[model samples]
Target chain A: MSTRHDIAAPPTEGGAAPGRPAPATGPTEADRRRRARLSRRWQRDLRWSPYAFVSPFFVLFLAFGLFPLIYTGWASLHQVELTAPTDMTWVGLRNYTRIFDDEFFWNAAKNTLMIGIISTVPQLLMAMGIAHILNYKLRASTFYRVVMLAPYATSIAAASLVFVLLFGRDYGMINWALDQVGIGKVDWQNDHWASKVAVSSIIIWRWTGYNALIYLAAMQAIPQDLYESAALDGASRWQQFLHVTLPSLRPTILFTAVVSTIGASQVFGEPLLFDANKGASGGAEHQFQTLGLYLYEQGWVNQHLGRASAIAWTMFLILIVIGIVNYVISRRLRASS
Target chain B: MTTTLTKPEDAAPPVRKSRKPRAARAGGHMHGGPIAYAILVLFSIGSLFPLVWTAIAASRDNNRLAQTPPPFWFGSNLFHNLDVAWTDANLGEAFVNTTFVAGVSALTIVFLSTIAGFAFAKLRFRGRGALMLLVIGTMMVPPQLSVIPLYMMVAKLDWTDQLQAVIFPSLVSAFGVFFMRQYLIQALPDELIEAARMDGASSWRVVWHIVFPAARPAMAVLGMLMFVQTWNDFLWPFLVLTQTGNPTVQVAVAGLGRGYTPDQSLIMAGALLGTLPLLLVFAIFGKQIVGGIMQGAVKG
Candidate 1:
């Protein structure tokens, strides 16, 4: 196997001394034979060391990563409870079929989709605009970047705690400001759409700056000549951004979209903490309950292990389908380009 | 997602027409305008105001916080509230527990990822491509899919409420391995490894003397990122660790706001205490963290 690289060729026995002088009587047959055996041992080390190096990660991944995934799928086909996770009865596809009739599941699914769009779309567009502005030679840009990233540094628990207080209907800062400006108070937690927007805003607030930095990285990496060429053609700044910058950033845009979608689907902590009094029920009427929260409610809160397993598999299946569609679209884009 | 080259490439640019007269027209006035600065200023406030207000709210009494037109300025009761949150919320223990868990996890992840990354980056091993693809695939397997079995194993091993329950599952990261592999492939030259080999350096010696030194910067950065991630991880920790007994920061903080009549200021204080350490981390090593994310984003 080490034959792939010419430079890794095994050394010949006794590989001539670099700066030391050899004895006039040279090497005895036994000395040369011993050196040849040492060379083979060294060659063996070279050949096998890479496997030794990489085994730890694969081993850990197998145990904690791969096995659990398959086990969850297997457990989904049975009826089990949190009281005794080991006690299982065969109920093939019942959990999956029950999901079809589960209204809470559908509500969570709808909320997940709406929240995903609300959170991801504006976050990315704002990120794109910010990244464009940041491409300008600015003063104290790192300071801006760091300050923008401060929200990201805040944990979900902490951020949600702060936001819940800020968005309180009666005594919150936003309502106070709105009242001062002659606007009526809005019940953020009780109102269905308002609650979802409030939840989505937390995600957007945390991630927009991060995605902006990513886009900024991509923008900085754009070859300057592309801009110059566009300018030579007398394109306006906005036009250059549309024609040149946007096209160059296609892959980065797709990348962020995929990441945000995955993140959006797994929206748990924000909604969970946003309604701290109600715990896993997202809201009083389950208005903003995402799939992730629903999974938690079924498994941990309600102790329906089999149902939770099914939800897990269902989420995985949805992600896989989306991934396949993404792959096809990207492939077509690549082909056409 | 792995197939996407969404990460910005940091490759060296080809030759440019540096002296061309037309270059000035393209980007000579690249500085932001007044309107741009205004927008940036507004965004910065939106980004930072909640954190600033958390401090204000933390310093006030519970009654003050529950009143309309919340205190915009600091209150004298900050230290008093912090003291209460510290003792009542068991944040002191949580801080230590979280530090140990995050530190051990980050170090293990960095060390293992570097060695494995070196293998994937340079070594000519059997099934290298397939194995690397497997590593990439592992990144997309959501934690929700895998937690039930991990929970079962933890319960079986009597690891519930133990730091090991949290630490064990986070010991290695696929992203760490991928990021390191990307770095070493470009940073560590093959010629150098070949020279070391020619000098009869054993595989271990080559890793120690050559690979690690080349990987020091990336290793440090990756350690910080992993630390932040593990520090902020909530769901799994919430499931396993009980707040009263062995809470991490998030669990402890989450516990603060519960019950029929909660102390509002005390909750804010706990939230502030839990968030301050990492914000300190961001304040200090932020630029490097920014660099790390962007660098890892491209190939990672």
Candidate 2:
């Protein structure tokens, strides 16, 4: 720590504070030559420092990020296990074929897509509404913004655990609230649709505020004059939102939508935690099993590393397809607009 | 736009006229009516309800929680649950592990990203733009998609069940690099770098002295983001650190809900313990975090 403090001390002591540049002094010929010589020597080393600075990330990425992605493709071809990876037998395209035939894989995929859509659509809409509301000059907006992000601060595991209690079948607050409202007690974890709703509720609860804040930021950046002009033209708040805010927020909306979709597709922790009683298969019947959980169940629990690789690659393709679709749609919107 | 507005007006003249004031030019101190407030309040409650419920449950023991209506208020068992969480639940070790991993990872991310950001933002070097773009591009590739391979890599390095399995993989975030680079581009000037260079300071010295201090607000935001993310991360840690000894707070909290004899109060207490520190941090640095996320989203 002291060594670090020592290394850091010189710049703080010697360099001017931000926004204040050092004053230029007239340099004598001798001084200029000395500086040039020093610079020439330093320049040789300086050329590589940026590379040195940036290499750590790329190195980590290559090892952990890119290599894994590419290796998943290679590994999926072979029949491998977590423990005995070297004794693998290559069976090209067999794992993919096998996963395709596996009903559990399809079940998991459907669950993932269902939950992703169930969570994402309402989350984004609520986010937009909240952003619109918060964009207005409201008292204690900062406090609301902070409160909105409270769920974001909570770890997914912790949040899911809390939700488990809330969504409890017999003693849950949700059922209690429903009972108070004269509705029947819905078995949240047992029923198919109810479980999806319960799971999506967790996702929605966590992300809506975060997405709203993003939209609010974009909304804030929209020229205030646009709204004023719209108002001067006798447009109502609804009309202004439709004609002004919504149109202006297209890029940000698309961006957030794409990001949210990508994130939702990889829903792991919530379902994993939500399936507390049902083990890691998502449920006894694999009701809420997402692809992420399936991958874990396969690779870690079943020890079928090859099959997990196939699932990983499948997820990658789905994301890429969605990404390309989003890109095309966004580009078209930009072009038409 | 005018034609569209007129069309809407024609379609629903009375409804449009009635809603006019609500939409009355933007930038007012208030938006929406009592209905909007009601909706926001309801949604806010919905958002906070789970945590509130958990807190209530945490205060109650198993029997009280199993009551027909369930306990809705603080019970005497709060301390007992916390004790169980601390001693019996393995959360004490989990807390220690989480702090160590998150702290180390956040510090490393900030340090590496800031320098890389500095290099990308101000340093004139060959392939700088391309390299920076490559770094930015990695953000598009969701890391979870590569989990299988990453698992193998960790295992190959014999790092499984270790905290470094979590820390090393996350030490340098592409998002942090991009975020820092963007901030530096706007906050820093080439004149500052040249000025320091002219002062007979080494390049490293110039960066440490001039660029880093100036980049603190950005770095702090980035570091806080990383810390919170690492604290909250589950899947990677859950996968790598399967051992009871190495479990992160999040993994430990997850484990609370997974057992055959799952204790509601203990789980709730454990969740609270895992969540509260970051929530407190959120309360303190909420504005900066909000700003950082907003800026990141907007810039993207």
**DockQ winner:** 1
Off by over 4 Å in 2: A1-37, B1-33
Tens digit per residue, CA lDDT, model 2, A225-324: 8877888999998899999999989999888888888888889989888978676788778899998999988888899999999999989888889878
- Candidate 1 chain A has its poorest 10 consecutive residues by lDDT at A1-10
lDDT of each: 0.84, 0.80
Quality class of the docking in candidate 1, CAPRI style = acceptable
TM-score of chain A of 2: 0.87
lDDT of 2 by residue, B169-197 (tens): 77748999898887777666566666555
Q: What share of the true interface contacts does each candidate keep?
A: 0.56, 0.67
Clashes of 2: 3
Q: After superposition, how far is residue A150 of candidate 2 from its true place, in Å?
A: 0.9
Residues B165-220, candidate 1, lDDT per residue (tens digit)? 99988875898999999888877768667666665667886788778877877899
